[model samples]
Target: MKYVVVIGDGMVDLPLKELDGKTPLQQAKTPNMDFIAKNGSCGMLQTVPPGMAPGSDVANLSIMGYDPKKYYTGRGPLEAASIGAELSDDDVGFRCNFITEDEGRLDDFNAGHISTAEASQLIEALNQHFYRYGKFYLGTSYRHLFVYKKKDAATLESTPPHDVVGEPITEHLLKPENDPLAIKLNELMYKTSKILEKHPVNQKRLDKGKKLANMIWLWGQGTKPQMPPFVDTYGIKGATITGVDLIKGIGTYLGLTNVHVPGATGYYDTDYCGKVNFALEALQDHDLVFIHVEAPDEAGHAGDIQEKILAIERIDRRILGKLLEELPSLGDYAIAILPDHPTPIDVRTHTSDPIPYAMYSPGCESDKTEAYNESSVENSFKNSSKELMEGYKFLKFFIDYSQCKKA
Candidate 1:
């Protein structure tokens, strides 16, 4: 028996009036997702635990069966691992986003989705100036990273740039008084902004009438954390396929191989079929393969309803559709599909609401769900309580069930 988990990041959403009060999942044509719901048990899973932030760091950790309260440190350390930035015990990691600011207001969080090559040059310039206090490493596009040598920096409170888009930048500067290391971080950000504003990169962007990647926003700080490897926890080797560093970082620490798929950009333009091809090939050697798609989440953050719907349809057709058609040839397998959290279109951020999930196994009992969406799962739950279960709990159950069947 084999296992596959498909995570459509921030795929869940609230109902929209434009779609006749239907959520994107309901409005989108997701035949493959609907097929899973029809043949498998469906339920609402609370991926984000109580009192935890609804970021992918905590949510994906919980989805993988590790309790966030026990294992989660911060988002920075995870991304650090993905980019091969080794951190010492005393070092702290931070996610440094290259953003655009205008007239003291927060503009684009992604700086017009700046190209990695261009962002790399900007990060290199930042390293030349601030390499003594902390070092900057380019990851992807505006999603870069910084590692602070001081442990106290990990305690600093910084807001995610995405959460503060279109707001005043002054109101959201990092609070540094609480920690001396934070003071350094706050000071560095100001200095870096001044330097970046006049840099050649910003000048070029201005010439093009593009959003300038003028400032570095720091958030999601933490030291390296210790957690049991996934193989030890599940007794099955696994691989991960994702374009996002945070998810790939989690997989790296969990002893999972990261499958790099060309053109898998973690955006709407990502090559969806490439991810499916890599995942299928990975399954040939591993017992489990996890695939994460970030397009829906990005669309949600941009508050573009049509893009979100289109992303969902693409995942259904390109990723899951290909897997369902090919996996049967390999052997008996179970596929679990769910989002890490809800990036609602209206809110343009993650919500702590429970997300709907479906698990399809050969010859397994069905919940009679016809489509994969929030409303359909709610209706299915009303008919039977057997499908209702916690998100983290399902991970363990799925592993054990597959192990038993394999034996």
Candidate 2:
């Protein structure tokens, strides 16, 4: 089995923020990441198309070589698969977000930051009410990824009402502009909210003096993923190390095993050292290990450039640096570092610009002089594969082509 370790911020950004001064990456002191770049072959990656929503869910799919256009059914259902919610062929999956509803309008997206347990309980109650025919899965944080299986493919979709947070909940599902199924979804959203307002979970939280889980935001409707398992693609049994349910959900959906480790948090301050070791361990059992460091992206989204740098540096010093030092002793392992996409702190969203990436061996060396900007690694890369390619192209990066039969 061959080993390839992909490490970096895994989010393709939308050009939401204007380029004013030096980008956040340009300003950070990430010696470790810089070390990896100088020691490896560098290049760029575009994980999403222009003008599409800036979501890592789709972008990560692209990086794994799954074309978003072909595989993205919607964000929620893909996540639903990871949570073990079986969806029907016809049933659509929608990403359900927990939000606050004030006078029928989306007030805030996170529903007062309702605790994950509260979120899970609220979903259970919603399922108890509507799951008579379909499926509902509540995950960590205030996310509910759902699947409506065998319902007949339909063209209906909805997300949290945009922008204005404190207005009356809008009738997103019932609009005539959408397919009749969307109208049904809207009806379902309204009913779901009403039931949630009094859900036993919400009631329990409220009774316990906690915030009530009140509303839902939905987006990204998708069918199940249709691809060979990673093992089939690269001869390495696939395993993943992730703390966030979103990434975990991706692994679960893609038929990869989740290697859970103690002290791993799926948040900005997620343990870097712990995450790195987890990936290294997976290498013993499998050939490909997708190690995700989500903090830099999170810091950028928060628009805190300083925090973003710190997050970047933290991973570099703690994770990438150590990996580089141990390469010689690790035998035949290959390491590649690249951002999934641009998550710039300046605008607090994803960007469309090409991200700088580099692949390095144990003792290779180079002369890139920048820390984290895309410019540093541009010279190292030669071929630009437009967007992302799944399986075949991704696998070729690993096993020598001589190992494969002609197509």
Candidate 3:
């Protein structure tokens, strides 16, 4: 049997008063997702484990069938793997984001969604000045990496920039303020601001009235992780299609092929159709293909209600709609749709909420869910015996649910 999982990253949201008190999922037209819910099963899955921060790295790891508590090191190491930045045992990889600091506040986490070409030049200047501390590796956009040789640096508590936008930068810098490593890293961040402030890239951005990537905010640090490959754990060869480096990094470590699609931008303009087309092509050789879209998540983070709704619709129409049409050619396929976690439009950050999911496989008994959305799944979940399943267990349940009917 073939398997496909479409992950609409941070697609779920709380009910917003502006959207007529309906969540984005409820407000958006998702007939394809609703079809799966109607024909298959619908319930909630706790993608982010209790007590863990609801970052994409943790949540997606859980969805990929690896318990985050057991396997998650940090977000940095994952992106490092995706960008081909090898981390040594003593090296602590930190997720370096080019952010805008205004009047000592964290003005913007993404530096106005700076272009990759502009970021590349900034990355080069950073490495030139900070080579003694660590080398910066360019990933994409404002997302980058810095590998510090000291393992102790991993213990420093650095806050995610996206989580604290408009907050005082000093209040959120590397914590336990007395630690030497924390002090050093925090000082490095301040120094970075000086270098970036005068750079030609920032000068051009200033001329254009764009947010300056004038400071590097470092967080999510960890050494390399030790885990079994995807095939060893699940006995299925899987591939991943995503624009985000973090997802690609997870796939890299799990022995899953990272299918590169030129139009997958990890932004609002990301090519939804191209991602599905690539996943379909990858399925020709892979047992399972995970199609992860980041646009919805980006909209959620930006708190753009219309954009989030648009992204959800695009996923339903362009990705899931197409996948439903084409998967039948492969025969006996199981298709599942769910988000990694809730990046509530109001909250504007990842939340540890149980995400709704719908899965369909020919011949399996359906729960008769009429729609795919937060409210629909919650109502269905109350009537079903399946409580909120753990994120890691969902993969096994999905595969077994499909295989049991064949047997």
Candidate 4:
């Protein structure tokens, strides 16, 4: 089976500072992607809907032609279920994060780049002490993947209390103010902190000149997803290569395997070559490969435009370049690469705008474009989402329109 490899970092788009300012793609050097966009079909895609609450989770589903409202139960359980964590009809799931909380004020976020092991230990410790019918699962360190179930609906109403970055976690917490059932969350938060404070793993890392994993704050609490399995719906197996817990969790929830490679970094400084290799190999074992990179969004979230550009450029050369180089050897497969959403470096938040998108079928179009952006591809025949779906109508038509082909 031929596979369409979707390669791009996870979402967290920016509100481009200047109306006419260059996009991250325009600013970054993406020769191979630019070449693909120009050689084949390209256009502006509103991967997310016209007016939907935006997130990488929803954008990806939309790009794949799944309606967000129909498919997204919530992103948390998908990530949770990805890591072997399970949820039920009565259960609630949340994305818990081990961000840097101040030891002095306990107010600051971004706890100095805490490592995953420290975060995992903290979650394990938190997991050890659960009262009644609630459960918390730790994922990839920075993300605390949690699930809860109560017999009564009242038990699940309280939600994760996070509004903006750097908001006092103390002020925004599981409380009666937000949820009557939130009384026990602050206890869990304090417990998770104390456990991290003395964790031998953290202490050992600190001794090794590594950042100490500190506090955890819960956010993105959501319900379990109900989307049909890809194999069931698309007649093809799918797998993802990513470190971000939510995407991994989603892949897991959908029963998609998370690809692991030798020398895999599992984070921003990840091995880009390793990711492309995973995509190429997936062609043999599966029908679709979802290669999710996290660094660009991380850079954008950090307000580091230069770093975001570097991440994009680096991936373009290392990951995207390697994939294209190997394409000739692996005949008959098409490549479609698009971002789940725009991660504008300066703004560092998910923005609702049509992003530049493209698809490349070998021998379809021979000319490579110099760059990739919104306005470059509208003049071509590959004008709609259906035309861009790599010979399948499953994505753009929102149904089983796979009775025909362009290849």
Candidate 5:
């Protein structure tokens, strides 16, 4: 049986008064997602475990059947894997973000979703300037990797720029009590800011009235991770399709095939239809295919409620709609759809909320869920609580519903 998992990253949200107290998922036109709920079993899946930070790295690992508490080292090493960067036993990798700063305040975490071409140039300049401390390698857009040639590099306490949008950078800068690496990282960020402020890229961006990619924010540091191959974990050949390096990195480390779709950006303008087409082709040989869409999450981070609704609608029409129409030709398949975590529009960051999920396996008894949303699954179906089924176990239960059904 073919297993398909589509992750709408950070698509879940709280009710908003703007939409008459209805969430984006509740109000958006998601007929395809609704159809999955109508035909299959629906429930809530706590992607983030208790006492864990609700980052995509931890959450997606749980969703993919790997216990993050055991397998997760950090976000940096994961992205490093996507870029094919080899880390030594003592070396540590860091997720270096190109950010925009204004008047000592953190302006934009994404540097206005900077293009890969422009960001590559900026990363090259940073490497040229700071060749002594560490080396920077370009990933995609603002997301890049920095390999620090030191063992204690992971101990530095740094905050994610997304978590401190509009806050003073001085308040959130890296704080290391006695660690010299942390002090150098903080100094590098400040020095990079001054250099990039005078660079031609920022000058052109300023002239064009675009947000400048003026500073480097370092966080999410870790060493290499040890994970079994996807086949060994599930006893099935699987592949992953995503626009973000973090997801691709996880897939890479697990020895899963990473399918790249042209024009797949980790933003609202990402190619949803392209991802759908690629995933369909991947399922021709693979037993399982995992597709991740980052648009809804980007919208949530921007607090663009309408854009989030539009993103969900696009996924329903361009991705899920096409999948349901074409999967019948492939073979007997089970499709699971849910978000990794909630990037609530109000909070504008990841939250530790149990996300709603739906799984449609042929011949499985439907729980009579009519719509797919935060509230519908709770009210209409008898669902499993986070206390009952952990996120890492959800995949095992999804792929082997017969065994789980009897248990």
Candidate 6:
């Protein structure tokens, strides 16, 4: 049987008063998602385990059937794998983001979504200056990787830039100020600001009234991860289609094919149709294909309610809608739709909330879910015997639910 998992990254949200007290999922038209809920089963999935930060790395790892608590090393190592940056046992890979620092505060996490072309030049300059400490590898846009040789650097507590937007950079820099590694890294961050401030890239960005990627924030550090191949764990060859390097990195470690689509930008303008088309092709050889979209998550980070709604609609129409139309031809397919975590509009960051999921396979018993939304799934959970399933368990449940019904 063909399996398709469409992950609308950070697609779920809390009810917003501006959207008439309805969450984005409820406000957006998602007939394709609703159809799955109506014809199959719906329930909540706790993608983030207890006491863990609700980052995409942890959440998606859980969704891919690896318990985050057991397998998750850090976000940096994952992106490092995606960029082909091999991490030695003593090397700590860090997620280096080019962010906007204004008046000693973290102004923007993404620096106005800097272009990859501009970011490449900055990455070169970083390598030139910081070769003694580590080397920086360009990934996409503001996202990059830095591999530090000292394994102790991984123990330094560093905060995610997105989580401390508009906060003092000093307040959020690598913690335990007495630690030599933290002091050194924090100094490197300050030095980075001096180099980026005078760079031609920043000058050009200032001229264009765009946010300057004026400093690098390093966090999410870890050594290489030891993960069993996807086939070994699930007995299915899987592939991944995503614009984000983190997702690609996860797939790389899992032995899943990272299908490259030219138009998948990991932004608001990301090609939704292109991702689905690539996934469909990958399915010709793969047992399961994961289609992950980042636009909705980007909108959530920006707190753009309308854009989030638009992204949700685009996923429903351009991705899920098309999948529903074409998957019938592929035969005996089970398709599932869900978000990795909730990037709530009000909170504007990843939350440890149990996101909703809906899955459909031909002849599977339905739970009588009226629609695919937060409210509907909450109601379904209240009425049904199914507790909120762990994120890692959802994959197995999705794979076996249909077979058990047919039996």
Top model number, lDDT: 3
Give the Å shift of residue 284 in candidate 2.
1.7
Give the poorly placed runs of model 3, Cα more than 4 Å off: none
Off by over 4 Å in 4: 10-20, 103-110, 129-133, 151-163, 174-178, 198-212, 263-266, 365-370, 374-407
lDDT over C-alpha atoms for residue 43 of model 3 = 87
What are the C-alpha RMSDs, in order, of all predicted structures?
A: 1.6, 4.7, 0.7, 4.5, 1.8, 0.8
Cα shift from native, residue 53, model 5 (Å): 0.8
Could you give candidate 4's per-residue lDDT for residues 170-253 as a string of tens digits? 566664545535756666666666777687876786688665556666655667667667677666677877766667666665
Alpha-carbon shift of residue 39 in model 5 (angstroms): 1.4
RMSD of 5: 1.8
lDDT of 2 by residue, 118-192 (tens): 677777778888875466776767667767663443345444333335555664543344565655566677777
lDDT of every model, 2 decimals = 0.88, 0.62, 0.94, 0.62, 0.89, 0.93
Question: lDDT per residue, candidate 1, 1-407, as tens digits?
Answer: 77999999999999998888999999999988999999887878887888877898888888877888888889999999999999999989999899888898889999999989889889989999888878998899889889988887787778988899999987887775556666677778778888899889889989999999988899998999898999899888999999999989999899999999999898999999999999999999998998999999999999999999999999999999999999999998999889999999999989889888888887776767988999898788777755546667878776655444445
Could you give me the TM-score of model 6 versus the true structure? 0.99
Query: How many clashes in candidate 3?
Result: 0
lDDT of 3 by residue, 1-407 (tens): 79999999999999999988899999999999999999998889998999999999999999999999999999999999999999989999999999999999999999999999999999999999989999999999999999999999888898999999999999999989999999999999999999999999999999999999999999999989988999999999999999999999999999999999998999999999899999999999999999999999999999999999999999999999998999999988999999999999999999998999999998897999979999988999998898889999999999998986668
- TM-score, every prediction: 0.96, 0.81, 0.99, 0.81, 0.97, 0.99
lDDT of 6 at 55: 96
Give the per-residue Cα lDDT of candidate 2 at 88: 64
How well is each residue in 84-199 modelled by candidate 5, as lDDT tens digits? 89999888999999999999999999999889999888988998999998899999999999999987878778788999999999888777645677678888999998889898
In candidate 2, position 65 carries an lDDT of 55
- Ranking the candidates on lDDT from highest down gives 3, 6, 5, 1, 2, 4
Between candidates 2 and 6, the lDDT winner: 6
**lDDT score of residue 226 within candidate 2:** 68
Q: Model 6, 1-407: lDDT tens per residue?
A: 89999999999999899988899999999999999999999999999999999999999999999999999989999999999999889989999999999999999999999999999999999899989988999999999999999998888888989999999888898989989999999999999988998999999999999999999999998889999999998999999999999999999999999999998999999999999999999999999999999989999999999999999999999999999999989978999999999999888999998999999997888997999999998898899998889999999999997675469
